[model samples]
Target: MTTLPQISLAKLAATATRREERQRLQMACEEFGFFYLVEHGIPKEQITQAIEASRRFFALPQSIKERYGHAAQGMYPTIARGYSRLRGEILHPDAGPDPKEVFDLGIDSEGDRRPFAGSTRFPDDALAPGFARSLLALQTTVLDGVVPQLGTALADLIGMEEGWFPRHFSPPTLGQRVIRYPARGGTCAKHTDGGFFTLLLQEELPTRSLQVWFRERWMPVPSLPDSLVVNLGDMLQALSDDRFKSTPHQVAHSGESDRISLPFFIYPDIDACLTSCQGRHAFRVAEMMLRNFESVEAGNGAGRARELQ
Candidate 1:
């Protein structure tokens, strides 16, 4: 029974003397690649609002929800926003499709057509008032404040030159999802996040669903109402030369009642060229991101995960 390391974001953000907490973060990144981040400055109300809004959105009739469905459901063929019904994604191929429904959105840019960019299709305010605003407010706070501070700390741990990460990381491309795991279906299969890192806020019910790979077995990461669960992902693993692994984990929603979790994926500017730590090769952010999504969308993420690992 391994305990996921709990690191204080405030301590990590402390001035020059923050080395101790920074080292702890590095250790967590190296050993477990997952940790509970406390003191992360997100308001309790924002979280509550998002979760409540998600519940309302999901509780709507199927016909009403489908009005905002992905084109595959026969909406906008070019965009991949809005609602996706149950069994829509299979993060781990072996376990088959996930028994989950998801509503996804990125930063709402009016007409930007770049990959993972452009305006989001949100449910009307009359239906779910404050839904988009609440989620985006939470995201904006994290992205603008906590995310950069944490990234700088990690960069220091990895010995990246000053300003290296920020040089090409302006206005990062991000995706946020409000995901629901039904009470009866199987778990979200084992898989690692595909971005630089992820900010996860798990709903307060069924507190024992998330587990991470550690020391040759699955270890539980029970939910803590006040903290965010952070984890390393493939991009960071690549940038750090595998020093920080993107640990594989899965969800096994237990007991009765539905479970919802929000995950915010962070990526660099699409045109940025990321050179490996060892300078082995450089790749464009857009190509890497598209390949990651395309593989999963095509149900071949298991193979892609193997390659990245």
Candidate 2:
């Protein structure tokens, strides 16, 4: 029944005494593994345009969208890029497939042969004008602008150098995804994200159905307008030697109209290896996705639990 903490990026930056902010971030990561971010400096207009552009893209005919589908174009090997239809991805074996459609894009490169270093498939000019530009702008803002600040705060909490966390993301292997769940009760089964963190932007609708597993129960996450919800991911949990939890969360079908969400996964270089100072354990970035996929397919019960509300 505890509400997620709301942390102000501006306050965290300007405050002379950062001890409180550091403690708050540490506790949130250790306990809830989720929080609301405010005043993060990403323009509201950019966020709005990104959402509107996504709406236009999804409104296109199913056939046109399929032309750019991830599987149709063999984009699965890159981890996640291009379009995926509803039920295309099964993140939880016990909960079945997720009833959602998503368009994914990741760091673009030509020379790097890493698992996730590949070009994104953008919509053609005939589909939606400026769609690629708007989406890219929003993605860059969060990755370049918002992430560094949060990363610095995280490093401070852990007693590492200020920029230690963000430096690993130089030429980051991150991904941006825009998803739509039509109708109510479209469950995105309980699971943890596979990267370092996730920043989600959701439209404020009649129903906000995101739930986080906490304190041995499922808890509802309020949908606040003009705010981004940030959560820890599996890689971070591993990096912290399980000190920072990667809380499991799921999206229950909304009983109202369609629901749209934009979630960006923060990844490091494919070869980046994270070692916890406390536990002396090492986690490779490249292997985390494969490990997570296997767990989901094998019905691993590590992050899964009863969702009774």
Candidate 3:
């Protein structure tokens, strides 16, 4: 078993109060670009339930799954929007299409009218009982516990008050993606997340393989119980004046059973600016991601672009 680096939030938070820990976290972000966060406040049962719900939902028949598809943005079952590979297009010319199918959910807000906003399609009792509620409950709990902490930590990393981020993320556009990667014959090609940060809870270990970009190389990120993997997106990297990095990563083909992962993406305010604050680093990250998003949507996947809002 590979013993990956671990950061106990309780200890890190305790150390953060001492200024030295704060420096350590900032350095970690700069150097590793990804980290395994332990002792995060979310309970074990909640995580388990979320995974269980995801498995149940994905296990539904394909005909039933398509009923909830978001055709406009390519959001639907077995298809990934923005991050999933195009039909018949290999993520890596050398590799096959990513074997993952996905369903996405966003914050339920009335009259928000954002590009990604709307009521998510839920199966009725005929399809599955209590499915939507269970999934939403899990989403709420995970976001409620993780987002604020991540925001505050990020603010501190940039020399701002811990509460500074909430001002921008108030009623944030929270998005949830339920992904199912079939056996290792197909895998996600190399790509970066489109949101500011991604919190992934793995339902099972990687049957094929999972890898993350770090220190200018692709390193395997092992799946462990009770641990969530955190990765900085392009926006964070740009906002930090390149202090933090949004590294590129991919999932390799697995010949065993399929893999499932539930990822909750936290996006920044769409209209937020990308300039430096109080002599801190500039906020060009969001802008960079936007540009990358557009390019990707324009059929130029080979270009190094970031995620879209």
Candidate 4:
């Protein structure tokens, strides 16, 4: 096992209640770009069951999996359909094509009605017995453990009321992606997350390297068991006036074995606007990031770069 950084959520959560601790969390966010959350309240069994269900779904035949393809909403099973593919322009240009297949889900909010809106689908109960219920249970537990705490901490970091973020997220729209990477050599190209925050639950340790861009260099992030890797996104950076960095990252192609990962991306309300310390610009940075990400995925590298800049 590789050595990984340890962050005490208990300490961070406790600090969130106090002004000083809030400052520390904000400082860490600005400086490090990422953090490890430990002792989060999600149960171990729930994570395990979800992982098992995910494995079963991915093992299905490609034809069977195609039943869920949702290109219109960017949901369903697909390989590299949500981001750019151009060389030297896509986030991970140097790395080879990402040898992975993924199923993505978006949460349902007000004015939106869709099954598994803001969530992913497992094989139906008949296809994989107990899969749907077990996965939903895990999702609920994980969300209960992290969402409130994360929102509160973020609110505190911005010196806002504890419930400030919650107001904007009452009907939060989360994106969950279950990814399966083929055996070594198919690595994810370098790129930054397009949401406000990401919580990655790794089912199996990755044999390929995972690197994060920090201080203008790619630094490897070690994978640890039973821990979720959390990363900030561009919305946070915009809200913080670039104080909180949104680091670029990628997974290297592995040669030893295939890999699986479940990442839950937490996003704000669709219409929510991002402002700064003075609350001057009420622009919707989150939506913009999403738009740019989609453009890149559609092979509009030049357009995406312009929007990003």
Q: Is candidate 3 or candidate 4 better by lDDT?
A: 3
Worst 10 residues of 2 by lDDT: 300-309
Q: Candidate 3 at 179: error in angstroms? A: 0.3
The residue pairs in collision within model 1 are none
What TM-score quantifies how close candidate 4 is to the native fold? Answer: 0.80
TM-score of the candidate numbered 2? 0.91
Provide the lowest-lDDT 10-residue window in model 3.
Answer: 77-86
Q: Rank the candidates by TM-score, best first.
A: 1, 2, 3, 4
**Residue-wise lDDT of candidate 4 within 1-309, one digit each (tens)?**
123345555665674444565565676577776776677777777777777876687677766676665543343223222221212134443433456777665553334333224334345787766656765676677667687777678756755665777887765657666666667664666667766678888754645367776665667776676677888876666666676767666777464766667788777776677666767434674456456556555544311133332
> Candidate 4, overall lDDT?
0.61
lDDT of 4 at 223: 69
Best by lDDT: 1
The parts of candidate 2 lying over 4 Å away from their true place are 15-17, 72-79, 293-309
Show where candidate 3 strays beyond 4 Å.
Answer: 1-4, 12-21, 72-96, 204-208, 253-255, 278-299, 302-309
Per-candidate TM-score against the hidden true structure: 0.93, 0.91, 0.81, 0.80
- In the range 196-218, model 3's lDDT, one tens digit per residue, is 77787775464426787665566
Residue 184 error, candidate 4, Å: 0.9
Best-to-worst ranking by lDDT = 1, 2, 3, 4
